[model samples]
Target: MAFTIPEGLHPDLNPLAWMVGTWRGKGRGEYPTIPTFEFAQEVTFNHDGRPFLNYFSRSWIIDAEGEIIRPGASEVGFWRVKEKNVLEVVISHNTGISEGWVGQFDGPKIQLVMDQGYSAPSAKIVTAGVRLYGLVAGELFYAYDMAAEGQELQAHIWSTLERQVD
Candidate 1:
């Protein structure tokens, strides 16, 4: 497929334009501190002809039969072009955790490493994380590894998403 730069998109966001859309997918989650689980996930990246990309994501825990058991983590954030080839993301979670990450974009692949995170005294303390996202053959695939509390960084979530709304 041919890719064209959409008119009216902020020049600063031009390089990250491929990510502007809504994605729906299924993901698996596991951590030493939490039970293994499955979830339905949705993520959106939007732009208003501005310097940053607006971002939002939500997940619902699901049962083996693919039924929603309960709402899981929800996050709102912004992705900005911090340099010619680097992107910065700042996100806040409903669980009272806030994080800042820096990433490098190469072709359709993005690799993000968390620089710092703060957790509310009452919430789980997430120390660090790494997220990898890519667009491959028109599909969105991502994996996340995280270190929290006293545990080492380990694979926590992986998913494949199809663009829902362009």
Candidate 2:
């Protein structure tokens, strides 16, 4: 089913409105020396006529037969059109990484580049990274470019999620 963008929705949110729903998909992820893991994830985006959307995601490793193995969860803070040219997001992962980002929206896509980073709650200083997101053909796509622990920018992860249900 197709989702209908609510009337009076903010123009700055148009590019992201298509993501307001539930999504389920399988993805492949790699980090450091860890083995390439197969994972299934569910992401939900919701809004209530506000300037920003609410985001939540849950992921877990799955075996070849599609059995869940390990679980991971994250909460994402969102903002759009605050001052007319910026889209911001602050994501907090249970794994101890809190990221802050800001970007600009271009037509059907958005390019969010990481602006800063810090430890959760403590808000200690930390290095930054690069992350980007876009919407294409009814799917939301993401790429992470991070430099942590003295490492250089690397393609940490990429995911494509399609709307599943309202």
Candidate 3:
């Protein structure tokens, strides 16, 4: 589980090296009074002598029988420095939600604000959103705020994931 640091990796991404591992956990999500759903998610962050970290995520809901209900997958994205004091992320998902983010790193957290749209055979829409990810007690905690459907700022989702030991 130890990875050698890539020589071409961006210096700004060094602080995020701790995230270069496999993570798995269950989390609760509630959006706009909707019924809460339980979901299990896994994330992997890797680098290979590149200027950015590669990222991928897969998630699924479990039913009473402890079986996977829905499969959610996201393609690997680039994580790198965009400016003198900002970081940028590009996330492409099979669900047609390709997004780009610009943000800053704070302590053990990263705050990204996004404004773009995705187009594919599936859902498509222009969205304005913000996501904050923080590491606390060896766990990854994240909160998402989005402005879509004429709605104001609202908490759309929150997730907590622990590093997984392979």
- The candidate scoring highest on TM-score is 1
lDDT of 2 at 106: 65
Report the candidate with higher lDDT, 1 versus 3.
Answer: 1
Candidate 3 per-residue C-alpha lDDT over 51-139 given as tens digits, one digit per residue, 9 for 90 to 100: 67888877787666657888754556878865555778888877677888889886678999985656565554536878898888888
- Report, for every candidate in turn, its global Cα lDDT versus the true structure: 0.91, 0.70, 0.73
Q: What are the RMSDs of all candidates, in order?
A: 1.3, 2.9, 3.1
Clashes of 1: 0
Question: Which has the better lDDT: candidate 1, or candidate 2?
Answer: 1
Q: Is candidate 1 or candidate 2 better by TM-score?
A: 1
Cα shift from native, residue 93, model 1 (Å): 0.7
The candidate 1 region of ten consecutive residues with least summed lDDT is 1-10
Candidate 2 clashes between residue pairs 3 or more apart in a chain or in different chains: none
* Candidate 1 TM-score over all chains jointly: 0.95
* Ranked by lDDT, top first: 1, 3, 2
Instruction: For model 2, give the 10-residue run with minimal summed lDDT.
Output: 120-129
